[model samples]
Target: MFSTGQMIFAGLFVIAFATAIFITYQKDKKLHAKNYKGAVWVAVAFFVFIAILFAIKYTLKN
Candidate 1:
């Protein structure tokens, strides 16, 4: 079983990853001003990439 601290750390990592994606999407949207779809896909890909990383980390840890 994972410890409470480990769980919290994982949650924080996910949140930070999401926040970073959101910030990047916002910046790209503002900068490009016409490629909202591309920005959204980029954000989605980023989040998925982070999730995959987390999954791999957890799998290795266990």
Candidate 2:
């Protein structure tokens, strides 16, 4: 187990990292909107394909 110092340092590091990422994403929001417009549909298709595979596997197991 880590001492109090390590834990505190890790917590602070996570907070700072997350904040930086959020700020970067905010700055890139406009560019993302322009370039990655069809991302949602791609994600949906990927999830649907995985679900179908699982359904087939489950059906075969019975």
Candidate 3:
């Protein structure tokens, strides 16, 4: 039941979420090489951002 604009927005949101995950993974790889702890926090923050994006999208639809 979504309009074209809504669908496009949702797709873009998903892309953004995926990009965040990719960036986090790359950072994790570098951090792992350096033996840093920030990678865990980066992953946590990425998921939180994705969750927030989903919440906003659903809220808009409802």
| Best TM-score among the predictions, by candidate number | 2
- TM-score to true structure, per model: 0.47, 0.92, 0.46
Q: Which residues of candidate 2, in runs, are more than 4 Å off? A: none
Compared with the true structure, what per-residue lDDT tens digits does model 3 show for residues 1-62?
A: 89999999999999999999999999788667688767788999999999999999999999
**In model 1, which regions exceed 4 Å deviation?**
30-62
Clash-forming residue pairs, model 3: none
Model 2 lDDT per residue over 1-62, tens place: 99999999999999999999999999999999999999999999999999999999999999
Instruction: Tell me the number of clashing residue pairs for each predicted model.
Output: 0, 0, 0
Full candidate order by lDDT, most accurate first: 2, 3, 1
lDDT of each: 0.90, 1.00, 0.92
By the TM-score metric, which is better: model 2 or model 3?
2
Clashing residue pairs in candidate 2 (N, C-alpha, C atoms within 3 angstroms): none
Local error of candidate 2 at 18, Å? 0.7
- Candidate ranking under TM-score, highest first, comes to 2, 1, 3
